[model samples]
Target: MKLLEVKNLIKHFPVKNHKGQVVHAVDDVSFHINEGETLGLVGESGCGKSTCARTIIRIYDPTGGEIIFDGQNLATLSQRELKPIRKNMQMIFQDPYTSLNGRMTVRDIIAEPLIAHKIGNSQKERHEMVAQMLKQVGLNTEHGTRYAHEFSGGQRQRIGIARALILKPKLVICDEPISALDVSIQAQIINLLTEFQQKEKLTYLFIAHDLSVVEYISDHVGVMYLGKLVELSESKELYKNPLHPYTQGLLASIPALDIHAGKITDKAEMSGDLPSPISLPSGCRFCGRCPYAKKICAEAEPPMKEAAPGHMVACYLYS
Candidate 1:
């Protein structure tokens, strides 16, 4: 079942000292995540992947479009109205150092969600629940008294995961959850998240710049560029047959030693800096740097259309 559906989602930030100019963080983007499946969103840094995730989770109010979660439109809901719905949704932020509370013990940090939603009846009850969550995330109950700073980066992330899952949220937005950790530690975190998903039957919107990690964990993959969803397809299909030029360039940039050797056919290397979001081009956002850009690519933008079965791309070349 589709657990979260975002349609034509738009989020724009006003440029400082520039009247009437805005940074188009996420513009007319759309996708969905079904229950118990993972949807990985990948793009270059500053491509609005994190912004899309935040807007979906309501950290930032969307500028336009619909956000439907479990059949309810959340775009226009008031904060009071959103509170109840938030229990079924949670986010694991990118930075573990800043995401957790240092002043609070590990126990209180994990129990905050429970307290906010009034889950447990008594203090002792909540403590037990926190303890169980700690264990589930690979921490001991004794560590509950320690501060977030006392733990390593990996352990702190585990605490963050425990906090997010304490409420048993149906949808979890993992915003580059493993970006800050060591290479060795990244695998552990990924495995932990995978284990929890299977056990809890959770759905994930995993956002990252690392395509390798996204491919390993995601059932479907969506490629974004300059606030637009350029392409989307099943994980294997996207890696095997990336239609969009941007998607092809992204895959080519991946180290050749990557497990999927000889899979990428074309050397669609991207050049030049990304176009500024504040003053976007009238045509395709990637036209400025695309190697295969034609006159039509500069004349008008292309809408996302299916180029193959289960594969969608937004480019004039496909049209």
Candidate 2:
């Protein structure tokens, strides 16, 4: 059974312009993650990858559509009603430095989730669990006694991971978890996350801008453009055979070594700026930058159609 299902999810932020307008951050996006599977969401900054992750975790209310998790529609659940459900879902924010509370000790930060969920009876038991968790994430209990500021970037992130995994949540939303770290640190964090996922049977909605990293860590990949999911397929298939022009352009940007010369190849070039989300062009969201966009593409929106089994795309060319 699918552990998480999102249908036509829309998240728009209202802004007051000359006339009240909405920022189309996430629009009509739909996808699902099976039990213990990782779904990688990749797009440029402000393409709604982070917004989509936040909405799924109910950090922001959905403007429309359903966020079905574990058979419950989380979008409609009230704060009071969603309390228990929050324990099953956790988020590892983008910036490790900002995500941790500098004022609090690492132990408290790691134990906070358990307290909020009312897990483990007493403070002593929670502290004990924190010690165990610290060890699990390659941290010492003595380190947990110190403040978050004392640790390096990599260690702080490990603290964040320990906190998120403390409750053993079934679904985790990793919002560019390794983006801010050094290249070497990034690999360490990725390996740690992979280990935890296997041990816990966790499902992940991994949001990232690096296609290479996404392909490495994901089972399936979803390409987003201007808040809409333009393409989705198994990670290997999506990298090998991208159907959407935007997906092709993204993959083309990856540095591929020329075996004969040991040099990088040409990147797929894109022209024009991203259109304002508030006043998005008619029809396809990517038409403004898509090389293969036709007149019909600018006239009306194209529905998501399957070009191959288990591979979906939202582009006029495919239709």
Question: Which candidate has the top score in TM-score?
Answer: 1
lDDT of 2 by residue, 14-68 (tens): 9876467899999999999999999999998999999999999998999999999
TM-scores for all candidates: the values are: 0.98, 0.96
lDDT of 1 by residue, 180-285 (tens): 9999999999999999999999999999999999999999999999999999999999988888989999988887775655666456888888888888898899
Which regions of candidate 1 fall more than 4 Å away from where they truly are? 258-260
Cα-lDDT of candidate 2? 0.92
The CA lDDT at 166 in model 2 is: 94
**RMSD for each of the candidates:** 1.3, 1.7
Error of 1 at 251 (Å): 0.6
